[model samples]
Target: MKYTIFSTDLTNPLAVWQHFEGEERVYWHDTQVNRVIVAAGRVKRITEAELADYPWAWYSQSFFDTIEDPIWQNMGNELVVFTHYYVKEEGKAYWVTATDSAPVIAPMTVPSVQHTYEMVTTGDYTAWQSLFEGIQQAIRSGEVTKVVASRKVAFHSETPFQTASIIGNLVAQNEGAFIFAYGKGDAVFLGASPEVLVRKRGQDFMSYALAGTLKKDDIHDGGDRLLHDPKNLREHQIVIDRIRQTMLAMCDKVDVQATHIMELPNLYHLRTLLYGHDTKDSILTMAKALHPTPAMGGEPREAALAVLKQFEPYERGLYAAPVGWVCGNTPLFREAGDGLLIVGIRSALVHGQDLYAYAGCGVVAESDCEAEYTETATKLQTILKAL
Candidate 1:
């Protein structure tokens, strides 16, 4: 199908987001550049194996490996699909038309939404902590150095959830985050994430490694305590070392930065920035290689992945998976245009009156069960406030 582009103006892209809220739609606010895109239509779907060839593609992680739990059947396995999308940039909204002659256009007016949102949760805080004790025992037994133990906040309400308003609020409050709203079937996966899995601009690639956690309210020293904490440092360093080593394996040249503090509304993290020129030709390959970092999967990837599959209870689905687009028929995603993907951290799944929010903490030998439980709560506060 031939594509067309028409430029217009949009001050509140959320209006376009509201108008385009369909069973299948894409909303991406490029945090790197000042731009927003909302694409809607039933076009096509592609797999990860097919992703390298197409530039206009999007994907989410799924746990096909773990089949013990039945809750995951709703989301299925990981996905990488292609779709023509709209772009709003440089104070102009561009309508990305598909192969058909009829062109899609952005709505000209903003939407007003008013409703009461009430939610009740069945939180797995204590249970998740119990699992962490097991992880701690495993760590001491030399089974693994670290494992990310996570919890779920399953919320159900009588009132219908307002996605547009929630997304708009997320955008307004977190300018530094990659704001997104992804809808499929009866479920929508949405969040404002602060982690980048990998971004490919030509042969240049960048990755962000974030681990360790401390609730901001509890940190009386304003990160002085965080910077010195031994457990947090060890957890954070594991992620840093893993990412740097992995990237160096695939890149011609690489730069790994010293650890720094990354503060959020409710918490603080030990963050590192890494970048390099990839020796490989494909951006998709670079993304797959970086996912399930020690931050998500734990040290000794293969063993940690096995632990996660058996212990995480619910399938991870897209909690820490890669989500972004690539261009089709291009030698490089950057060779044709720009391509970016961010880790789906600080994310949740919303369906009808039920919403399942997820948060995780990297568990190590020194991990205290109560402290790890509190860290997950701190992470959940991000989406809790948005909800």
Candidate 2:
């Protein structure tokens, strides 16, 4: 039997299926661009018999080559398969989708709630100190400008949870922002970030390159003054310059705004908003050009990544990686091709009761070990409160 393809514009919500148990299914409102195709249920992979179960034309990322696809032709398309669960006083269940849009709502009996816990604790302070010392020594030798390092703590609990619920909570509390939660197998990532590396809203491309950091002190009278501190200015300039250079190589027309200050709950940051027009390159090409920016990774991508791989104790996976959606197969929206990627800062991975969270600070020539440590601790609070 042939199935009807149900693709919707970014503004329209489409009916999407989300699996609970291997046998149970629910409908959710998918208002975003990415299409959902079922590869498997909780009990098993999708079988020929289950084809009828999914009446809508389904798609999967198994075949598409991101690097080869054109940005405009595959607009409104996304390629990540996410498995998420939400746990709270209300109930516990899991849902998988490719976009952030809410799923189609369906009336169904709630499943039996399971009790579980996952705890994430930090590594020993001594180990952190040792890493910091090594980083400082590298700075003295002039091998790098900045290096961002992090650690994780994982604990397990019996209950299952929803990744969207956690993201919703964080985004609701912070507006004009992006919240992301993507999990594959045992690894999960959830972050509420205000900084946008790049957004394609049509033919127009916008980017906010943010760098420099300062902890907010309630007692300080001229706290905002810290945004312009020479150390902070220098840090931010490096990021702006790196982003501008990258954009120029891949974009047809690029314009950058003067640096400005943006405030978060814990601190102030320096941000430079950029506008650009996409070239003929695919989104993946543009992404490759811009990623590992000085903001998330560091200046001189290859060298910085080398330092991280050698010194960092854990693999980053998608921790500081890009997370968002892509849609629209049109030229104007080529870069925006229905895709939105937010930096995975202020994020956590929750399973059972154990929530694995991570935070990293940019360490530059003038960076103080104690100050960077404090900055990471402050960033962790975004996810820590929900747990």
Candidate 3:
């Protein structure tokens, strides 16, 4: 295969994103690294059953999830990359990094589909609050220290929805968040998230443990209130502790970074950054071990996951899962990292006009059913507003 590179000011990368067909489109943007990437045309795809047995990766691609359950074999896992562009940001400057099978040719064309269904699905607030209470009861009984509870609300339209338009809104509005969309055809997962499961740089590993939540518009300095809120702190600490342990066990050397407050557009979280010694076992090794961190799963990982699996009314397909790409034999021109995976939170799934949106809150002993219910609503606002 041949490859070429180029640059341009792409106001709406989604316009370029339209070129990739079927399950061939991928879009990612990170202000932390100051880069916006739009990868199209699936030049290669990699799938793994388990990280411990997976072969060496030779492409910069993204991977999906199966059931995180040990007893069950992986359902559908894939890595996609090498046919794309990487847009980087320097001091007050922006650059687009592109890699392709050939030089650009063909006018940009947008894909279209007719609506096949029209149904609006929403969550039962009373029922969800009841479930949240059950999780909190488990926490009180010492059944699990913490559990992240989630709910889904979907919309089925008579007209097929446009991925380009949804993504355009994401780029135009969401700021300082991990933005991404994976998959194609009628089934796709996309979102602007504030959590990073684990990030691999050249020789370092970074895992972001983000839990706890309060509305950004709740208080003048939400960060200050979030820091002192004992309930939120307890919820956030469980995630930090679990991640630190996971890194120490699976990685060579580990650094447990300090915990701080991270504020997003409509929400705030207690955030901790963890780093592990870099080795060949970077992304794959760490992600498998740290995924579904207490932030997504719960304390005593297995028990909480069991609770979620049994109680949650939905499949969770890729919501609260992992997204982003890994590098191939030849890395991209950018210096952001070896590869990156963002915890697929604050996200939604689109299949025609039927859009399934999801949101969740961490449940601890101190959690109030009504309050936690409110948290999930806060979490869904980003994508809900975007749509």
Candidate 4:
């Protein structure tokens, strides 16, 4: 495998620096390699038969079906670099830190701080409620078991959104996670996720699928009350059951941690951490076994996905999809073949002045519409404040 190094100055970076960007191609950010995966001009809209010719083809409605994953190669070792935003127009792009006085890579620089502000205010709550009602009606009529619905709030700003700052903070704060930042036109997807769907550790591979949601208490002593809630327990169990069945075929050993307290910025969740060790499988194989877990998708995987297809008006695209980094021939710093993958939750795609934010909750037979809607609102607040 061959690798290429590209960079721009720190003062004027392009959005491609934050996201591996190209037209009609799939650009993968291999964080472990400190480089990118680029397969330009290989992507096209094609039939399923044609896609079979490519080994790593992914189909999303927003983008056609003929996309292929890039080939992996070793480019010696590269320095860890960052992106800075210097331009904003029809779409936003950034500059990446480069090695020398070469323009092979675009300019790289962080966006100015004057561009930051909270644009998503409580005024959008009414629109969110209306969308929530639509989802509830579907659930009540049995059209779908669960719909991971979301909404977008526009962050009107002249300066471009900051991508490098958020990624740097996530990497520095969560060493066990993957930092994924990308911009589609003006919308940017900035995610710092710690969850892993599948990871390779030599012959032994692992995955953890988390589910369930709740609100954290302001009082210190409210912990016990939150843990004992029946609603919370049920939500958590649904996720565990879904993951267990999904991985039953591929895992040598599956150990599920009993329900425990886990907290995010806005809310809390009853988390049952599942540990799967594969003896005969690779990480990608395990991922194929479980890519979109019940946490993002729903129980009875196929059925849930089918429901989402019919009921969801907006295309999910990369929202609620797997967003993370892959190790490109790099030894795991802590464990062999260790890489990080996280569900793109509590995230947004910023395109120019329009910001698209996404949030979803697990719905069961006993779930309530108002409460679930509120949960999503809490989730949205996390990324909304950062803008």
Candidate 5:
């Protein structure tokens, strides 16, 4: 099927987002290129086999390892094309024409939302002690070399959350990350993620191995402490090695950029960019293989995942999973439409008045329980501050 695009007067996607009426909605802001795609209303619920029949679709998957939890199942894992979508990039905005005619880009005002909320964080020091010891045992017994341990914090408010406003806040504040949201019914999973799982444009492939963390204030002598610290560098190298091995196997050529400090509002992270050329695999396929990397899961991926499934207190759901969109053979074309999926870190799941926010840290042999706990708490602020 062919899809067309037309110029629109829509300037602010956040304004359009507030007025859109759709049971299923998707929003993606690519900070790397200043691109935004807001999709609303389901056009068709297609499977992996029917991808070519649609111009564009938003796809999401639960974390590779899951449990029998209804909250997650309620936020179904599937692929779908929306009836209407708005795309803006390079100062140009357009509305898409799929199976239905394009709708007028009417002016709309976003309602004022209250930002006050009450929060209750789980995983106290006692709980952290238990998890830290378990991972330490796992590492000692050769069950896994490293594990990324995650924690969840819950928030409550008298008023229901305004997702669009939260999204706007995320976009405005988190300039270094990609802002993404997927809403179905009363559940919305949204975050500003600094880790790109995969990005595909024709045969060009790009991903980032991001691990190691320190507070922005903790940096001394120009991040040299973070750069030279043994524990942080060890954690960062594990991630770099994992991605290097994966890309070497899949691509004709692979290259890694110098590791540098990535500064965010609350923290500083060690980041390295990995790029390659692959003619064999599709974007999603590559993402599936590279996901749950040492940065998010651990080294010796399966063993780390087994550890998480067995001992981690809560189910991850879409917390650190791959969530992104594919524009297959659409007017936004460059031979094959671009694909981008980001790891869902620094994110939250909004269900009405309650919010579940997630954050994690790499637990290496050198990891200190207290330090990791503090790291996760700081990470949670990415969403908390937006709220």
Candidate 6:
């Protein structure tokens, strides 16, 4: 139950990720706070029951096991990895946390290589139409109120993709996001995500209701139109109501901040931050309770998920799942330390020369198939620009 700390340079943290080419690695960079964590090499495989002993670990879980897919299955479909080598970088200071005393590791040289690739959508308009029709039918029939629909696009390159390059590009181009890269051998799951599933700092807990989206184009009034659009408002309110109820059940006191627009490089999201105080639940517990929060899974959680399972042509895997890290020092200790889990939207999975990127949007009864499709395609640009 001991860890060693040592000084290290993290000016170019992506180089540190490249250094451990042969080992499993996990990278987490919170751009808002300017904090980065890079962990490599596995010491032990952690279970749900072992959270107390190894509270500090990287967590990545699949959206849900709706279908069997080997690509994601090989990448540890539904597993959380605990590593021996962990490094934390905040501002100008850098330090390592490990289960054993390890030597000062040097960053590897990341070669500047230009890559060429072709892109193809996994599903076509007809496929998207079918899914949209299905969801609309369900909503009209009162089987479900809203359902989030998603699709995948694949990029095929002549040469194998470099994980370090992608990570570096994501950090440089994307702002106000949690930049992440999790790699094991030839497969890597990476993205720049803006939605927080849940974040815990001691007894203070917070979750974001980020549902409505609008392109931040010159034609539109930035986020002003998104703020007043009735369809978008209804979609966003669904998320706020669900999260508020869940927080109230677990917390002694809860407060939802004023609604505002979360502006990303490509789009704007209606965001309402919720806070819960003095909770006995742990980070993992809070994350599990709030994941796929209408923002991803849709309204009446279970019913929407069922609709997705029946209509979504591709497996979501970790696309919109809860992915993050947890920290603590003792058992049954809800008061221990801090942790944050973010919804894995705007993400991609890399296998050798093939990279599959995913994006989704909420579809209420009033949603139009063509409009939703365009929105999702625009959202995919977050990862495409990085590539």
Candidate with maximal lDDT: 5
How many steric clashes between backbone atoms does each model show?
A: 5, 41, 11, 24, 0, 0
**lDDT (tens digit, per residue) of candidate 1 on 51-149:** 445446665555334434343444534443424456677666656555544243455644334434444654466567667767777778898999887
**Candidate 5: tens digits of C-alpha lDDT, residues 212-248:** 8988784365466788888899899999999988888
Q: Which digits, one per residue and each the tens of the lDDT, describe model 4 over residues 1-387?
A: 122233323332223354445322223333333333222222333332332223232222221112231111111011111221122112332222122322344445545233455465454666556655665666677765555555555455666556555544443443333455543333456654445676655555555545566666667644466678776666566667767776677767777776776655545556666776655654444565675676777655666666665555445555666544333331212332244455666666665554666777776667776787778777766665554
TM, every model: 0.88, 0.70, 0.83, 0.66, 0.94, 0.92
Candidate 1 lDDT (Cα, whole model)? 0.71
For residues 286-321, write the lDDT of model 2, one tens digit per residue: 565677678877766667777776676655555666
Runs with alpha carbons beyond 4 Å of true place in candidate 3: 7-11, 21-23, 47-76, 82-119, 278-280, 331-337
The TM-score measured for candidate 2 stands at: 0.70
The deviation in Å at residue 345 for candidate 6 is: 0.6
Model 1: lowest-lDDT 10 consecutive positions: 329-338
The per-model lDDT (C-alpha) reads 0.71, 0.54, 0.68, 0.50, 0.83, 0.81
Which of the numbered candidates is closest to the native, going by highest TM-score? Answer: 5
Worst 10 residues of 3 by lDDT: 52-61
> Residue 71's C-alpha lDDT in candidate 3?
17
Give me the runs in candidate 6 sitting further than 4 Å from their true place. 47-55, 65-67, 74-88, 97-104, 107-113, 330-337
> What global local distance difference test value does model 6 have?
0.81
Residue-level lDDT tens digits of model 3 in 1-387: 334445454444555667664645667778667566666555555543222121122222122244552212232355644455534445322222233333343555443333344336654786697678778767777889988888888777766677777776775667878787765555667888888888787777888878877787745988888888888888888888888888777667888777788878787788888887745565766777777788888889888887876777667767787776665433433232266777778888777667888888888877777888788888787876676
- Residue 150, model 5: Cα distance from true site in angstroms: 0.6
Worst 10 residues of 5 by lDDT: 328-337
